[model samples]
Target: MEEKLKKIQQDFLNKTKDTKTLAQLDELFIALFGKNGQLDELSKQFKDVPKDELKKVGPLFNQIKQQLEISINEKRGTIRKQIYQSLQNEKFEIPSERTGRKEKKGHLHPVTQFEEDIVKLFEKLGFVQTDAPQIDTDYNNFEVLNIPENHPARDLWDTFYIDTTNYKLQTNKLLLRTHTSNAQIRILKNNKPPIRVMTLGRCFRYENADARHEHTFEQFEIVYVDKDVSMTHLQYLSEYFFKSILGKGIQARLRPKYYPFVEPGVGVDASCAFCKGKGCKVCAGTGWLELAGAGMIHPGVLTRGGIDPDQYSGIAWGVGIERMTMLKYGIEDLRSLKSGDLKFLGRF
Candidate 1:
């Protein structure tokens, strides 16, 4: 057994010296040390050896195994360093052959471009752009917006609430804001009226996405507050904005709609540009495409914002930027806007 072990050790040293590559070293290592390998097969011979020799053979076997492992590791490092130095000394150049394809240039995403255009239009109308946190308190998101605790309207927003105990928010409830209209409450609280401000940002809800709906989406909300702000002003601004996007001669229609924060609310619709109000699939054969929800701010919401509702009136609207972009560009699927497909976005 002693003679056999010495022979195996000499063979290992010779093999290690000749090894020129990591792959070769690895193959040698497995043949000697791996399961069912040379060392493993040799260890089995202990049963056949005389009992008097067993103790000496076992200790020598373990020592050889440990030393071989260290030697192989050091050799591996040396080989790797040599390979790296060779690579560093080598020179390379690009092929001179022409591919004949023009490199593509990147442009703003359709959603981003749409957002910029909307901002420019409102800015022209003297509306200042503003932003609010995506994660917000229940009070700012719901209570201050007239959606009282356990109100049926709360069901309208399938909310995604954050764990307040885990997040340590000041309020017991924290959530991804269901609507950008929460900004209205925050704005009114911090600023004095004769205020014209717009918010364009992302909102979240628990939704099953389809052709027209998404779990997460972008929204644009504008709030205007001053004395004697009437529905006529709302109508005029809505029409002017739609015309700017949809081209001249386009018209807007307003029908009575219910909203928690707005009194005498309206559903704003535009004549479908695709079918010219003659009914089309884009408009779902209705000839009118719903654009936004707008109305006079409810006195309760105004008073909650620190403004005297009796002394002042205001109009507010929340529009889906995706919906407007789809109508303008004749896009059929809402999912495509967020699909992350460069091919689809490159068209815009």
Candidate 2:
């Protein structure tokens, strides 16, 4: 087994030496480390060794595995350096703007435009814009927000776990945040009461995509904590937001729902803008479109945030920017907001 490992190591080393472009390195990486690759196939043979022999083989196997990974990384760095050094020898010219000046107006992406409008509206309501990490620790994203590991509620979000092998000495479980609410714990722990902060950014979910869904999407969430905060405030904010965006006639209703992080959770739904509360495909024939999830912050969650639940109450809610944009523009397909086609984007 040791001899075979040494042979494999030498072979990969030689291939690494021959590898040039980053593309070639990527393909080589798959051959060596990807699923069902050379190393994986070899590791399967470990069980064949006697237990006494297995103990000796295991350590050597690990040592070679790490060495190969380091070698690959070093080769990648050398290639990148060569590319940058080559750029230094190359020359380029920028065309004079005055010589071929033509007016070319670029349109803001539909999602960005919608997000900006929401931000401005929140600013009026004393909500300061804040930013949070798109990639965050699991403790912040789920456990601290009242969704602990193995909780059925965790199934509500299909989270993307980070590949930590490349991250040096990382101990904490990390993931691509499934919701902007990942910022909720951060906001509460860092800020004192009367905190009205909103965060807007990209969220990732490992889920199938269709016309109305995306694997990656934009989300905006507000974390509000203050003395005597109540469900009334949540309702008011929802109604005010819907009326402002969809005209004063638009009505928003709250229905009892279950969200692990909040007490008395409610789903905020709005009368269908397309069918005027009548059944339609856009509303899934429900006469209302689900817009946001919200509720009074659970006492346990507040305690974890270093806040005395007895003194301060809180509310948290999040909205999908793409969905709101769709409602505002009478867009039928959520996919269109992200589609790069000029003909579709030019309209907005």
* Number of the predicted model whose lDDT against the real structure is largest: 1
Q: Candidate 2 versus the native: TM-score?
A: 0.69
lDDT for position 298 in model 1: 94
* Segments in model 1 whose C-alpha atoms lie over 4 Å from true places: 1-97, 165-167
RMSD in Å for all candidates: 5.4, 18.6
Q: Which lDDT tens digits does candidate 1 get at residues 1-348? A: 988887888889788888999999999999999999999999998999998898888898888888788888899999999999999999986544565556678999988898999999999989999999999988889988888789764664588888767665567778899999989888888778899999989999888987678989999999999999999899999988898987886678899998889998999998877788998766788988888999999999999889999889999988999988988887878899989999999999
TM-score for model 1? 0.72
Question: What are the lDDT scores of the predictions, listed in order?
Answer: 0.88, 0.87
Clashes per model (N, Cα, C within 3 A): 0, 0
Clashing pairs in 1: none
Give residue 289's lDDT in candidate 1 (0 to 100): 82
Please give, for residues 1-348, the per-residue lDDT of candidate 2 as tens digits. 889889989999999989999999999889989999999999999889889988988999899989989999999999999999999999987666756865568989888888889999999999998899998888888888888779753564677877788767555477888889888887888899989999999999877876568989989899899999999899889988888887888788899999989998999888878898888877888888888889999999999989999999999988888888888988877878777888788888
Model 2 Cα shift for residue 150 (angstroms) = 1.7
lDDT of 1 at 271: 84
Least well predicted 10-residue stretch by lDDT in candidate 1: 93-102
Shift in Å, residue 84, candidate 2: 24
